[model samples]
Target: MSDINVNHILNQMRSLSLQAAGKPVQETGGSTDFSSLLQQSLASVNETQQRAGRMVDAFESGASNISLAEVMVESQKANVSFQATLQVRNKLVEAYKDVMNMPM
Candidate 1:
């Protein structure tokens, strides 16, 4: 949830719906390509995980400015994002397998 934007996801779904209905999608600043969106999402998740790790390291090193509550919150955020990414990967693999097994 930390790296995931619900609004962005909803917008993408809306765009896809428009495309399926043979309507033009409006121009937007964000990349609409699937690969680009996926890359950006993965990068966000990576950043979140890295940030959490750094915070944990700093706290373990006796950093006075860092608080246990902040570290825990960041760590949980990272874990949730990672879990979501893993689930997405699993679904993508399943989809690929299904497409491959579709016979002519």
Candidate 2:
């Protein structure tokens, strides 16, 4: 990958890490709204999935224009993100169930 693309990806990853760590991207920014953060994370996951789907479609369509390495990387990213989301959902469901079963 070109230096620019690599730098962009690294920057994005850094931003994501900061968000996940409950650190604002800017000093002037305050606490992030939970709903907004959840929505943004979901949107990012959806976008990754869409990109992976497009890569698969391109490959199946006999388009050699897209590099195999790029496709693989995107696919792996989508898979990992999906798995993380699924795990989070599972944990949330379990917590809710436990709460509901608790004595008042």
Candidate 3:
């Protein structure tokens, strides 16, 4: 199983967003709504975690093809991804607080 690095995927998403917001995609042109991008990322994370849960359930039920090692790895990856998402949310909240505290 090829593991996708959540941070790398998020970085690529951010780069694409910067290009989309009037910066020119490949110097062509594009735009992406930040809220939609965030929603998609959240959905992706949720889906990953769900899949990991399913894998664990299958392994626990003694599914022959599902190895314990595979289950552990998938669960760990999901946990890490969720943790990363939480960190991103924390940073965003902190930034919002900083902006709100700025004097008009």
Candidate 4:
């Protein structure tokens, strides 16, 4: 098999991160809500995981024409996305704690 392009994947992820960051808040007659953005992101990640699970189930049950390689790749993608989200959450929590502990 040909070698995987790590740089390409990293660049793609960086581009996506930038895009998400640069999204303008909807003018719903109010300020931007970070909670809603976080919820949307978490929902998206959950959907990805659910899709991967469905693909694996279909592949294992032989109920579809999906290949084992495709299932594995999707599974890995879901896992990596979860890990990245978890890392971001960890950093956010750490920052929150630091701020809370700062002297007033």
TM per candidate comes to 0.73, 0.68, 0.73, 0.70
Per-model lDDT: 0.87, 0.80, 0.80, 0.80
Query: Which window of 10 residues has the lowest lDDT sum in candidate 1?
Result: 21-30
Extract clashing residue pairs from model 2.
Answer: none
lDDT-best of 2 and 4? 2
Residue-level lDDT of model 3, residues 19-101, one tens digit each, is 65434433212445678868966886798799999999999899999998998998998998799899999999999999999
Stretches off by above 4 angstroms in model 3 are 1-28
Pairs that collide in candidate 4 are none
* lDDT (tens digit, per residue) of candidate 1 on 1-104: 49997768878885895586466777565546788768967897899899999999999999999999999999999999899999999999999999999998
**Candidate 1, residue 65: CA error in Å?**
1.1
Q: Please provide the root mean square deviation of candidate 4 (C-alpha atoms, Å).
A: 10.8
Candidate 2 C-alpha lDDT tens digits along 43-83: 88898899999998998788979888888999999999999
Q: Cα deviation in Å at residue 97, candidate 1?
A: 0.4
By lDDT, is 2 or 3 better? 2
Listing every candidate in turn, what is its Cα RMSD in Å to the true structure after a full C-alpha superposition? 10.2, 10.9, 10.3, 10.8
Clash totals for all candidate models: 0, 0, 0, 0
Q: What global local distance difference test value does model 4 have? A: 0.80
- Cα deviation at 47, candidate 4, in Å, is 0.4
Q: With candidate 1 superimposed using the best TM-score fit, by how many Å does residue 101's alpha carbon deviate from the native? A: 0.6
